[model samples]
Target: MLLTLAKEIGFSHAAAVDPSSLKAQQEVRELCAADRCGHYGRNWSCPPYAGELTAAQKQLARCTEGVLVQTTGNLADEFDIEGIGRLMQLHSRRFATLARQARLLYPKVLPLSAGPCTVCRHCTCPTRPCRFPQKRLSSMEAFGLMVGDVCRAAGLPYSDGSKTMTFTSCILIMQ
Candidate 1:
């Protein structure tokens, strides 16, 4: 029922992952510390501002179940930056829509996306309050989650193969 609802809401793939199955790694936190994704300190949904790793872990602990969602798009090439950005944007929109729908069905949910919140071209983080706190989605990485490991634990593929870009997001549902 969850997977079907997810797909109907536009997720290409969805699976239930037990929250207890998630294992947070300091190594993943290190990647954020490195600013490899480049949005580290620039966005409200990313690192430093997203809160401590322990806090993220605690948030996840409150949820008993989650749905891993993926939207995979075929890239023209590895250097298709434009294609990649477009795909990510598309995936984010779909994820946000699904999240809102899920929120209606579920009493409480925490939606984590593949990247920082793009609800606005310029985020008003640190300087001002989030304009859409209710809609703002946090990044999975910022939540101290290793997307690949989480996918594996959920019996899902992190990658559909090379030349294909996959954006992953998860909705932690409290029941």
Candidate 2:
């Protein structure tokens, strides 16, 4: 039912995953520390503020399973920047809806997004408290998760091997 809802909400794909398969590795955290996306220490959903790696692992241990959701878009060329931006926006909105509904069904739902929280135009992170704490959804990277590894474990392809861009997110459920 949740998977169907995910599709209805506009995700390209959705699948179930075993919680045990999602591991929190220092290597992944190290990558996040690189701050390629530039949200590393700037947003509450990013690392440091996202919580310690141990805390993320502990939360993962409590989850029974998860649902991996993705939104994929074909690029016109190697530099289809506009297309990528559109897909990102669409995926973010869709994932937020899915996460919100999932929380309604299971209060303990943990939503790990593909990127930083987009609830605010500019996060009041390090400067002040998050204006919308209840709406902020942390990224999987923020939780020290390697999105590729999690997708592979879920029997889903992180990328379709096409000239496309894919954004992925997952909702962990405790039962």
Candidate 3:
């Protein structure tokens, strides 16, 4: 039922994961803190702004289960920036929709998305508080959760194969 619901909401793949065994790796957060993605200090959903890695760990500690969702896209080539961007956008949209649905079923659900929150074209961080605090999403890496490790722990494949790119996000559910 859950997997079907996830698919209907637009996720290409979905799986139940053990939240208790998930790890928040410091190295992942370190990469963000280094501003490698160019969104670390520029967005409200990234580190130093999203909240400390420890805080994310504490928040997920209360989650009893997790639903990992993925959207995979095929690129013409590894350097296909347009394809990559389009796929990421699609994944973000689907993840957000799935998060809203999960929130209805599990009120305390925390959604960790594939990238920075794109709910607004321009984030008002540093200048002002988040406009959609309720809908804002933190990236998996920002939360210090390594995508490959989480997927393996969930018995899901992180990569689909060559010429394919997969974006992963998770909804932490209390129930």
Candidate 4:
């Protein structure tokens, strides 16, 4: 059912992995500490706010496998940061919606988005409890998983060129 949904969504690739295969929490911490997202320590779903990667791994451990999924959007050039951002935002919302539907189908499913949890237009993540805890999700990068590596493992092409914007997201199915 999940695989079918992924295909319906235009995902280029999808595969399942044991949650244990994910990297360690400390590694995620170090990556976050580097402040790659700028929101590393600022957002509730990033670094200090998201807690250790170990915690993420532990939570994932309860799940039998995680389904990695990717979506690619064509762009005109590298300077189209705005275009890329908009495309990502669109994909993020679509991913979340699909995740919710997935949860209805598989009650134990847990979604981890491609980037920081973007449930709120402007997150009060640092200052307040998440507006939608059940819907909020963390990005794969936040867990210290080099996304390109993961995509390659899933048999997906991570970089087509500067003319394409690729977004990856995942869900852990505990059943």
lDDT by residue for model 2 over 15-115, one digit each (tens)?
A: 99888887888887788889888888899988778888898889999998789999998999768999999999999989989988988888788989988
Q: What is the C-alpha RMSD of each candidate to the true structure, in Å?
A: 1.5, 1.1, 1.4, 2.0
Give the per-residue lDDT digits (tens) of candidate 4, residues 1-175. Answer: 7777877876766776556665644655677688867776567777777766667667666777677877778887888988898888777877887798897888787787887888888888567777887777777777667776666666667777768988888787875
150-173: candidate 3 lDDT, tens digit per residue: 999888899999888999988887
Residue 55 miss distance in model 1 (angstroms): 1.8
Residue 163's lDDT within candidate 4 is: 85
Candidate 4, lDDT over the whole model: 0.74
Give stretches of model 1 more than 4 Å off: none
Give me the candidate number with maximum lDDT.
Answer: 2
Computed on alpha carbons, the lDDT of every model, listed in order, comes to 0.85, 0.87, 0.84, 0.74
Clashing pairs in 1: none
CA lDDT of 157 in candidate 2? Answer: 89
Error of 4 at 113 (Å): 1.1
- After superposition of all CA atoms, the RMSD between model 3 and the true structure is 1.4
What TM-score does model 4 achieve against the real structure? 0.87
Model 2 misplaced stretches (Cα beyond 4 Å): none
